[model samples]
Target chain A: MDAATPQLRVKRLRAVLQSVRPFSSPKIELEQYHTAADLAARILLLAQSHGDVAGRTVVDLGCGTAMLAIAARACGAGVVIGVDTDADALADAASNLRALEMEDGVDLVHSEVGSFCRSVAKRPRPAGVHTVITNPPFGTRTAGADVAFLEAAAALQPQVIYSLHKTSTRAFLLGRAEEMGYHAEAVAEMAFPLPKAYAFHRKSEGSVAVDLLRLTREPPAAATAAAAAAAGE
Target chain B: MRLVTQNLLTCQVKACMDTAATPDGGFLSYPLKVVPDAGGLKQVASPFDEGVAKSILPRLDWAALRKTAAELGVAALPEEVPAGAESDAGFLRSVYALVFDIHLEEGNLLCPHCGRAYPVRKGVPNMLLRDDEM
Candidate 1:
């Protein structure tokens, strides 16, 4: 990883920042999209289970600041596209990546998850992505964020999709996945705090969360073929 | 959980009660308070009953959390997390508002397991199960 963007670029960034700095408010005004190493580890595990991350193309939906993108590349993703509706979050993510010289490792795309999925669907096959990783919003007021991303990743025909969501959202997410004819092979859950995220907990209450989730389809015979061709597997 | 939702979902625990109850005989009791956090002052309302927030908060659906809290006919939240708004405060913040700030002083949490009713008294939900049900 080398400097991909200019240094000294001062601007508001979004959620990806929380990953860089947790337990502190972002100095710049913008939403924080930070991923914890704990969450990133889950994404990496998904990639490891499927194959490798270093050279594969990964589409990150609701990719708040490319935290997973950076992690994926570090693990082995060849090219990581971080997609989000927030330009500021994307810009911030880009800046963070640039600062870390991870620009070559990832690309930040400004678009809604739905539109991004459609665009990816239009691209040529064998684009080097066998996986789609994302951390979409789980607030029900905004329904379908995860579903839309999953549909989009499905369009890309990836072998697996690793999305982050609250454990409480399992019913909706799993229900929607089944309704859409998508297969969910497993759900890995645990109690974890999302970094840089201040979830007020009552002294009287205990809280737990599943910061990461991996929803993958079996590698298409085609994917195995492609990967085998690429790696001489 | 949203404060608004917390007000409704909390069960009265001291009565040796369960958090959720059926519509016929169930009631909820919660006490709410708002305080400061790293980012800003926060509001957390939980079921006055200790047993309530613990049992139900983990199970709350994010959407219903909004609907139950905003039962007073509040406006729909903005598309993006607006500054100074509840939703913008991140997931935990939102959950705090839903679970901690809003008082379940007079509500009942519907049990996902049984359709029986639990009642609230003095901002506490009586989630105690009957001998037969237990």
Candidate 2:
């Protein structure tokens, strides 16, 4: 019961989230492949190690059932917001938060990734989010969905972002992040397990090489000016 | 929505940002008012960590939280987080309740400036703006 350490909390979170069901819809081009609880915990742990999650505000884009969001909260994030367009996923996330007795720390928002990002961007700088940890669509079904999530997340200019993407897109993603004024680094690579959930998945379980990217925003001119002002220039 | 989130939320409508600027040229949302439905208030217990709460205290809009808390009939929150509140058990419990326990299951979060209403249904606030507003 004493989840005092980050490692212990991650283990507890994995067990709690494993029971939540993934939301699926054949209509959407992006298939709803749930991120394994262990993987989610690992990502949270990486973010925590980098001083991103603990006592910071975190936003999870395309948060299906809020696996990552819950993990972020368990890792000591002050507030975790999980944004998803799927009503079913949001409902499941709500239930899971209740189940974990974490309704207070985690919030589930029903909105598209772009809308949520823009809304957060519209807030004043002080209210701006600190970090974004998302496991977005791999773009297997939708050619550009993953990029869309990246674009929106970059717009918020969070201090740090931890994103999961297909390893094949590493080069393109790095280039894209550089152009968007962010430094992207592939911090970890793992075999992402794909459980057979849809009829199209021939294998009962498959694995794909995926990369966990840590992105830090390049300081904007305004930020530079503010920093100077703070230093009493 | 709890005061924890309400403290962070503001009118996302573009025009509301300008109104947030004070006469002294400082930026602060003039404490967004809430129309809470008492029937929809639900208390869901969550773990309370004093350290985490203390760490987040500096980032909170105390004025906004006080106003919102008063509106919700939980006026115990002080106008300012008292000195050494980190070790204050009563303060921590009150903050814990305001932040994590008090859930607004249904209501409208009205922007004091733009007058736009973000509806809360089933504990989720719909922050989507109108097309023209965006």
Model 1, residue A178: displacement in angstroms?
Answer: 3.0
Fnat computed for model 1: 0.00
DockQ of the candidate models in sequence: 0.01, 0.30
**Chain B TM-score of candidate number 2:** 0.87
Q: Each model's TM-score?
A: 0.47, 0.80
Cα RMSDs, all models? 19.6, 7.2
- Show the lowest summed lDDT stretch of 10 residues, model 2 chain A: A224-233
lDDT of 1 at B29: 28
Report the C-alpha displacement of residue B45, candidate 2, in angstroms. 5.1
Candidate 2 CAPRI level: acceptable
On lDDT, the candidate that comes out on top is 2
lDDT of 2 by residue, B31-116 (tens): 55768776878887776777667766776767777878777776656767799987887777678667778878888888877778
Tens-digit lDDT track of model 2 for A1-233:
24356556557667866876566442346567888877886677767666788878888988887888888887778788888777777787888888888776787776667866765555444555789888888888878888888998987788888899999999999899888789887777878998877778789999999998878875323343332222122
Quick one: RMSD of model 2?
7.2
**TM-score of predicted chain A against the true chain A, for each candidate:** 0.69, 0.85
